[model samples]
Target: MAEKEPPGTTVVIHGGNYGPSSQQVVCPNCHNRVYTVVKAEVSRRTHIIVILLCVFLCWPCALIPYCIDSCKNKNHYCPSCGSYLGTYYN
Candidate 1:
């Protein structure tokens, strides 16, 4: 028989470099090998760029950073179970 983990215990599995795109990882929640789903999110760098653009250029130009993937953070999620994996900062 297999021993069960204690309640409230956490398991952390580290994978390879998780960049702005999807990556393969062993899902910590489901224990499955799958590609992570990539989601772009606003980050500190993005916010700083937006603030700088608004002060130097204009409000409309500040919005440009929002549309650029390189200016955002990449969130990795398990495609199988939809559990949050990790984040890659810009």
Candidate 2:
């Protein structure tokens, strides 16, 4: 069993650093009603590799990755706290 914290204790909890994007979401970190800091749908690891393929293999081949699903993901985060809420696949 752990000891209880004193009455006047200040605990600072912080979140992670997600990409730059403005979105509205409830911040679990600060417990704010809602935070607007949605990030843009960023590319995935596979997408980068495929993009390289487009450059190396063929320039036009780059479009191939865009046409396919799972090539990118939409990341949602809290604007106020920057906590990762979830990811939406497009």
Candidate 3:
């Protein structure tokens, strides 16, 4: 038998694909309330433009650092499914 979880405890569950399948971290005390954070996607065009701007503006150091940092820590989440793709520290 599964034990009942206490209220206010966050529970992470695997979300299925389609048909109400969504990852979620729910606070048991809140009765199904879940929380999630999202990150922006960098498109190829945007990447190229950023690179060009770096070169033209003579800010290779700044631009390169930003790109490298962005690439280093990336979190993936499916709001539709509420799944925890991964986490980054630093």
Candidate 4:
């Protein structure tokens, strides 16, 4: 069963699997239909991978994780109101 949120609390529930791309969604803040704008950010996991690659493998290859979208987190925002919606973790 799916989890539920507490009463009087606002939550941004995603319809499907979100990715590093723009998608159509209903803005909870603005109460309007709009497309989401995605921004890629380096996460802790990416930092760990970079460190491991540099220590175990090579320093040059350590940058690979930073260049890959799957190694980062995608932050979703409502274009209409610019409210933070959610984050897509890889």
Q: lDDT scores for all predictions?
A: 0.84, 0.58, 0.48, 0.83
Candidate 4 segments exceeding 4 Å error: 1-17
lDDT of 4 by residue, 1-90 (tens): 998878965444565466678777778789887778999999999999999988896897889988998899999989878889888888
Candidate 2, residue 80: lDDT: 64
Residue 38, candidate 3: Cα error in Å is 2.5
Each candidate structure's TM-score, on Cα atoms with residue i matched to residue i, is: 0.77, 0.44, 0.27, 0.75
RMSD of each: 8.6, 8.5, 11.1, 6.6
User: Which pairs of residues collide in candidate 3?
Assistant: 8-29, 22-81, 22-82, 23-81, 23-82, 23-83, 24-82
Order of models, best lDDT first: 1, 4, 2, 3
Q: Between which residue pairs do clashes occur in model 2? A: 21-38, 21-39, 22-37, 22-38, 23-37, 23-38
Please provide, for model 1 over 1-90, each residue's C-alpha lDDT reduced to its tens digit, 9 standing for 90 to 100: 988989975544486457778777789889998888999998889989999988987887889998998899899999889999999886
Candidate 1 positional error at 1, Å: 38
Model 1: what TM-score? Answer: 0.77
After superposition, the stretches of candidate 2 with alpha carbons farther than 4 Å from their true spots are 1-24, 45-58, 61-71
Candidate 3 lDDT over 1-90, as tens digits, reads 999899976567443221122235553334354544544344454466567778788665535534554533344454545555544323
